[model samples]
Target: MKVSEKWRKVLRRQPRYWIAIIFLSLLILLALFAPLIPIDPNQTDVANMSAGPSLQHIFGTDEIGRDYFIRVVYGGRISLMVGVLAMLASTIIGTLVGLISGYFGGWVDNVLMRFVDILSSIPWLVLVIVLSVLLKPGLVTIIFVIGCFSWMNIARLIRAETLSAKEREYVVYAQFIGEKHSKIIRRHIFPAVLSTLIVAATGSISGAIMTESALSFLGIGIQPPVASWGSLLQNAQSSLQQAPYMAILPGLFIILTVYSFNSLGNFLRDVTLVEG
Candidate 1:
């Protein structure tokens, strides 16, 4: 038991865990204190336009001389929100469809699976791009577009998990004891599948961030005055010959953020599998 406890502590205290925690901590801090930060993200200094990184403007000024660092920080907040809230929206939708389909089976399962199949047939990025172009670009629009299409994969994963879990004795006993469908789902099946759900959700965040960036890159995502990492990148395309920093700074942030999420998701998948 002493050895078991020691192993448990070691498992929980991985170095990658510290890195994920620190990355997420700074992201949260940047978002919460964006307005209070010293730099003016939107205010442009015409004289300083296209300046490279310096103590005066740490991440350098963009073509319009806005503070790149400050914009990137705030863009982190917007992109993070789209990833998180959109994933939560997808989770709720996918979990419900999967639970009902897997628990009841027969015709219900067929219908839900077919719906997911139809959704999966559509190219997700193309669909989002079309939708973003049609709906007018904004934060909420991006979130909606992402959540609407991203739930199918989660639904399939949850359905597979539920099929296995329903055969387990606890689930059988719960049904035999006359527990409600919702109760069984909330209590028994959810806990069984939740570890995988967390990993899927973490991965979804990275996907959503990339999708939003792509949309912004195409000029159909979050609009100007309101920044996103993708929107920040858009500014540099025209000035690439003269001001490459416009593209480089936010591009690095996007890469770092996505890599952090991917690494964290892999770590969580391994950790959660061990726990299960």
Candidate 2:
């Protein structure tokens, strides 16, 4: 590698990357172990409804006096799960479609690209809303809706990467060696494209979380008794004028979560492109 290239690689592997990894690890651990935390998510304290931050309540209590801290911690699990699963669904389906279309590059490509365009033309949020309406409003529905809409970006990204990768010397050598298309793709192209996909997938999680929050804000996502940042916000919206902290608390978590994920995603994308 050239000097610039070597330096880039070193930068990509620096402590910031490790910090992002550690932050994500701890967030996930917090979500998983939410139940073990001292706060009670569902317990109603009618006497203390709409209380501001206190040592006992930490983030404070909601209208029904449900602990905001506990709800946020619990909400972390479901929202993150939806984002992850939805991204996985989109990545798997979109990667396969993109790879096949890019590799074949003929009538097959035309058909698939046309389908993608058709889907892309529709307002993604509208499409998600329509689909969610058709199905039940819950975790599975949210995942399916977000995944279906989220894949188009990945498909386009993968196609561009494949277009370049197909010209790489190794790919041609693999073909010359009489490797089957599937085998060559699986062994070579997939690994190379996977880094980009992972970076893109991280960004997609933010969108997925926002979508779920939107759905829940409209009362179509994770029903009551089930905690989600969006639903948590929804419950607090009406009382914002009176109990501002109720809305502010969950909103803070939402903002922080989205920013953290986005920062990590950008970091991944920059590092991966350099590695490529």
Candidate 3:
């Protein structure tokens, strides 16, 4: 069957696929229009400080009386941005490394695999925290740190896939037909690996979101004056007793976003397995 037909079948067969699509669509829309939304995240009303949920303030007011709802909306923008950029960066790096290592398969493979193994041995969260401390804390730094640390798993996954793919009959035929090495890898090998790459990308995005949130919660990512889910949680720490919703709203957004990506990744993994 054609690849497009297979993708259609997967979409029809997997409810998780479109469920993620809908969830993510809404989230992306919300994040995109957050500024136009009816509330100002930072606009404070001292008289309403620590207020509970009411019609006026949808998610209630924080310690300084900023609207929790708007803060959560704006926070989604930052969280999703970090997740996507980090995932893209990591996927690009991992794909290149895996392709080179698997295609070359000699001292090159050994060196790359050893490096991956060394990175895999480290506790990733610790590495992210250390890096966040060393670098200036901001959106770019968070994205870079998450992307740098997150590639090892995907690199190993793609390496395994590439090793098998390069040995396939089609690949051998391409080589025999005098196709350039780069061309063969780009055309034949990449297409073969694309499905698994999608799965890896979805997983990486969720992991990146979580990592950014954790870093922000630690007061190192997406610093104040600019809202992010993580920073919201960090700022709420002082008012946890007074305004529980301050943390709850942002935390809920994080959970929903991560869950959406995870479900999508699992669905894609299933689709790849079926196609394989």
Cα lDDT of model 1 by residue, 159-246, tens digit: 9999999999989998999999889988899899988888888888988889889898889998888989898888789988887878
Task: Please state the error at residue 194 of candidate 2 in Å.
Answer: 1.9
lDDT of 3 by residue, 133-223 (tens): 9999998899999988889888888889999999999899989999999999999888988989998899889999998999999899999
How would you order the candidates by TM-score, starting with the best? 3, 1, 2
Q: Write model 2 residue lDDT over 222-272, tens digit each, in one string.
A: 887897889988988888887888777767767777777887787766655
Q: Choose the strongest candidate by lDDT.
A: 3
Task: Name model 1 segments beyond 4 Å from true.
Answer: 1-14
Question: Candidates' lDDT values, in order?
Answer: 0.84, 0.83, 0.89
Off by more than 4 A, model 2: 1-25, 273-276
Error of 3 at 192 (Å): 0.5
For every candidate in turn, the CA RMSD to the true structure comes to 2.5, 3.2, 2.0
The window of 10 residues in a row where model 2 has the poorest summed lDDT is 267-276
Sort order, lDDT high to low: 3, 1, 2
Q: Candidate 2 overall Cα lDDT vs. reference?
A: 0.83
- Compared with the true structure, model 2 gives a TM-score of 0.90
Count clashing pairs, candidate 1.
0
lDDT comparing candidate 3 with the true structure: 0.89
Q: TM-score of every model?
A: 0.92, 0.90, 0.93
Assess the local accuracy of residue 183 in candidate 2 as a C-alpha lDDT between 0 and 100: 93
